[model samples]
Target: MNIKRIEDTLNEFNKIGYSRHGMNRLAFTKEEEKVKRVLIELCEKEGMEARIDHCGNVIMIKEGKNPNLAPVIIGSHLDTVYNGGQYDGSVGVGVGVEIICSINDRNIQPERRVELICFVGEEASRFGMGTIGSSAMAGKFDQEVMSRLTDQEGVSFPKAVENVELDFETIRLASREGERIHAFFEVHIEQGPVLENHQKKIGVVTAIAAPTRLKVTIVGKASHSGTTPMNYRKDALLGASEIALTVEEAAKLEAVNGTVATVGQCSVFPGAMNVVPGRAEMKIDIRGTNVESKQVVVLKLLECFKDLKNRRHLDIQYEYLVDKAPVKLDTKMINSLSTTCEELGVPHLQMVSGAGHDAMNMASICPTGLLFIPCKEGLSHHKNEFASIEDIAIGAQVLEHEILKSM
Candidate 1:
């Protein structure tokens, strides 16, 4: 395989505004359209059969010697977080395409077909719906969640589908026919410093951490800062700060495999500096490899809110934004990757994914495995995200070996 060509393709994608230091291809937007177009063109150039689904997912299939067998699938999302790193999703899809090219170049025909997929809207930034395309393909989503979501512009989910000329009914039924998948594999950046920190080239992911997103709103009476006595004030901002700190402390106490809690978003009502804030709303994201550890963290958060309700005599409301159980990768597939890496002289280690990916959703439908390469400085989803060219090439080689083994 020509690693330079793969790196060149990635660089070209970066030039397409796929990376502004990092990637900015949020789902269901014009940037997404550009990404889809580029991928379709690449597949066509390679003489692979390519098509888009009702949910705007891009699929490229390379025919094999035996057409009767189910295809071995390799993929990742094309959509990215705002200013996310280039390699996060792009590298996975790029490596899959490269594997196909390698197969064709060597005239190595497999018994099963191979597929490359670029799923749409895996990021929840736009429609507050993460894994929309994959979840629909897994038969896990329904009309209720679809109808309730609206973009920043107030475009409903159904309307967004319509805008893309997709029929909602067709997308809802996309999962029924995809069960023929023999197995699914994804190659992604580690999105952390683990591999680099350990001086490893590959990460054979054992499992993906489950993530729970909660929106907590603290309601307290707004009063004049100057006029309200310290003892008499029912300050929502103060209560929220306490809860936020409590969440951090709880994670530290329950640190099972590095369980973490983050308050990513916080809003205060009434922005005036002189006025006491009446309400504060914050989004809490928590993750852990084990459910029990996650539950402990969540229960501690609830307890913090309950305590604040009593101490401040304030009203509190909680809303669940997202709750997904952790997914363990197929052990067989992981073993295949590990063995291949060892045989090929690739540096590798077993690890769990800290960030969420489309691979998690794919696991619900078929046996899946995720491979990871390191990110420089443990940075991702930011402008400074980076991985070395050598690392990228090594990751692609590992993925190539894994795909060949799976076939």
Candidate 2:
């Protein structure tokens, strides 16, 4: 692998939306467009046919010797959450570009074509939904979902698509037939401390945990903080806080099942310090690989919400923002990855990903594999999120081997 070229490519991308806080390449933003343009230019130089599909995914194809065989698809998203780390999504794309570079340098023409896809809107930061590109490719995205989704700034999903110069009217064209893809693979940072703690260089993902996101609203009467007695006052923020703890406790009970829950976002009404909060909104994300175990936690949470509503005398209502079941990757591909790691003498662990990825959606269409490289302290989605170039190169080597092997 060309380590210098890989590092340079990643560094160039890191500059697009960079700030002291973190990367700001949120979906449908100008920074994301700039980065996509850079990728397209690079792919064009390598003699690959590149285009942005109606769903806004950048598909770059390097034709091989045989047109009969389906293409081997690899790559990840280019978008990031608000103040997210640079390496989270971009590393996979950089490594993919390097893979193409190596293939060209060796002048080896595989039987199957290679497609590197930089999917758009993989982060849910903007629309409260993610995997937009891959979902469309898997035939899961539609006009209804697009029209319903709105960003925090009140930008509808269709408007976001238009802002990026993509037409929503022809989005159906983005739906790819499953038989057209032979296999799919993605490399990403572990986003957790698992690999680093285990002293493993790579993680061959067995399955990806699906996220069930909820938007909760707690309503209570607002009153003067100083005048209202503690017994008489109704505070929505306090109720929300209790529910958050309940979420934590519920998740803890299911920790053995690898289930976890988080209340990542919370907003309280009434900005004045002198007045009690009249309402609070929270965004809850629960995930697990085991379906039944995850449902247990969800049921427990709903029960807790009811208890809180009755005891606190507050009106609590919640809407399901996202509720997707976990996805298991292809077993044949899993063994292939393990064998490749063994041949390469790379230390790898077979594990399940707690975080959601585009691979989860692709699994429905074709055999998909996800590889995880370690990040410092398992930190991701932050300014300091980092995965070494050497580690990424190692991942690229493995990815290249898999692509060639599949061919």
Candidate 3:
């Protein structure tokens, strides 16, 4: 395996989204398209057939000996969040390409074809609707879903498609069905410090939990900051703060399913130094591997909101942006990953994912597995995010060997 060559290709891919500070390949943009073209060029050099679907997903397939068998899919996104790292999604796509090329280099004919995909709009940085390519491919997309999505700049989904010079009507047709899919695999950076801290090279993900997002609004009457007594005044920002603490307490003490919660965004209305806050909006994100535990957290949160509204004489409202159940990956793939890592002398561990990935959506259509390599200090979605090429090569070798074994 030419680890250096693969790493070099990753570096070149990084330049496609090069920014002064970090990477900037937001989904469905021209920059992302260039990344697709670069991958297509790599596919052409390897004599693989490359195709792009309506949803702007790139798929390259290396035909195998038996034309009758289902293809095994291996892929990851190519788009990065704003000023993000290179290996976040490109690592998996690059490794898949390398595996297919390696097979062709050795002239080994396999029973099933190998496919590498670069899913478009996998990052929420573009439209806040991520996994568009994979969700469309898995037949999980609809007109209502697409119509409801809009970017921060007020660009709608269809409009963004036009901006990117892609066909939106064709996107409606980007669903896969009736085709045999052996399995789907994704190799990614751990995006966490667990692997690095544990001195493990590979992570065999057992499950990926779905997160529930809520946009909460707390309203109260504005009052004079210094004149109003604390006992008489209802501070909206203070109410939001109480809700945030309640959210954390519920997740930490009330949940038994490894639940976690975060208050990522908070904003106050009528910002002023002397004015008491009248309205506040906050974004809460909750995730867990166990379904019941997720429910418990939400229930407790709602109860607290009701109590706060009545006691503090305030108005509290929340809307869910994302709500879904946890997904358990393919048991066979998990076991196979373990065996492969051991056989290859790569240290590995079984764990569950706290973050979301395209693999979760892919699992809805086909058996899927996620393999993770360690990143530096578990930092991702940031400028300093990094992963060692050697670590990735190790994880990729195990992934490649496992895929070959299944064939």
Candidate 4:
């Protein structure tokens, strides 16, 4: 590994964004555009052809001895959550470029072309659409959904991109044409304490969990708090409260296959100290390593609601906001990553990712593997999230080695 090159490469983009607290390069914003231009400049400086697609994803290609073969693609997103850490997505983009530069410096002719991609809209901060770039590349993005989405400022997805001077129709068309990625590789922080807790240096991801986000509403009659009798009144807040507890109980069941359910948001209509709430809403999030297990938990929650609606005489309704499914990465890619870690004397652990990533969408188009390097204290999506240069350097070597083996 060329330590000087890697450090200089990361430094080029590390200072791209700044905030009162820390970094804030949310997708489609002006700050992120600056980062994209820097990416193009660095990639072109290394003799790689850089192109930005309709979805605003930056793809840089280094021609191989056989330029026609399906390229081995290594990438991560450039966008970040509001006030996010620098290393979350930026590390992979920087290290990926370093890998190509290192190969070029060594005068090694790779068997296939290699692409370093910087996906946009990976964070839910802007549009709540994770993997916007990769999903478009995989031809799985839903225009209807995008049309209906709005940001916190009430900006629609199409409007958000338009504000950034991007054409929505072009982005939709770009997504329809999925790229031919022979294999996809992404290096990201573990965002968990597993690696550091076990004293491991690397993590070969086994699977990435997908979350189902839903909004549940309960309706009942609002009545005078002091005059309403407990048995005579149908309390919406009470029903919602009971359902929330039931959601927890359902996920805790042993038969549910380790599914985790959370009702993290709740609201009561007529939110007052003396008012008996007439309506209540709760946001539900359920996730598991497999889609079936997640569906099972959802079914269980609905059943519990059915019994409550029947017995408590309340109206229950719920709508699915997101239903992303868990994905199993390519076994061959996982093995290749593990084998390389061992060959290079890098300490690694095999684990499941509890968060969503662009790699999850790439799996729809080709075999994809996510490499995890420990973040200090397992923190991510914040200013304090960090990965040591030493761990990152090891991950880059493992990535380059794995790419070579596949070629």
Maximum-lDDT candidate: 2
What ordering of candidates by lDDT runs from best to worst?
2, 3, 4, 1
**Relative to the unseen true structure, what is the C-alpha lDDT of residue 45 in candidate 1, on a scale of 0 to 100?**
80
Best by TM-score: 3
lDDT of each: 0.83, 0.90, 0.87, 0.86
Give the residue spans of candidate 4 off by over 4 A: 3-8, 175-180, 254-256
Instruction: For candidate 1, give the lDDT of residue 122.
Output: 84
Candidate 4 to truth, TM? 0.93
- Alpha-carbon RMSD to native, per candidate: 2.1, 2.3, 1.4, 2.1
Give the TM-score (vs. native) of candidate 3.
0.96
Per residue, candidate 2 scores C-alpha lDDT tens digits across 150-266 of: 999898888888898888888768888556789999999999999999999999999999888889999999899999999887799988999899889989999998888999999
lDDT comparison, 1 vs 4, better candidate? 4
TM-score of predicted structure 1: 0.93
Clashes of 4: 0
How far off is residue 252 in model 2, in Å? 0.9
All candidates' TM-scores? 0.93, 0.91, 0.96, 0.93
Q: Looking at model 2, report the run of 10 residues with the lowest lDDT sum.
A: 171-180
Global CA lDDT computed for model 3: 0.87
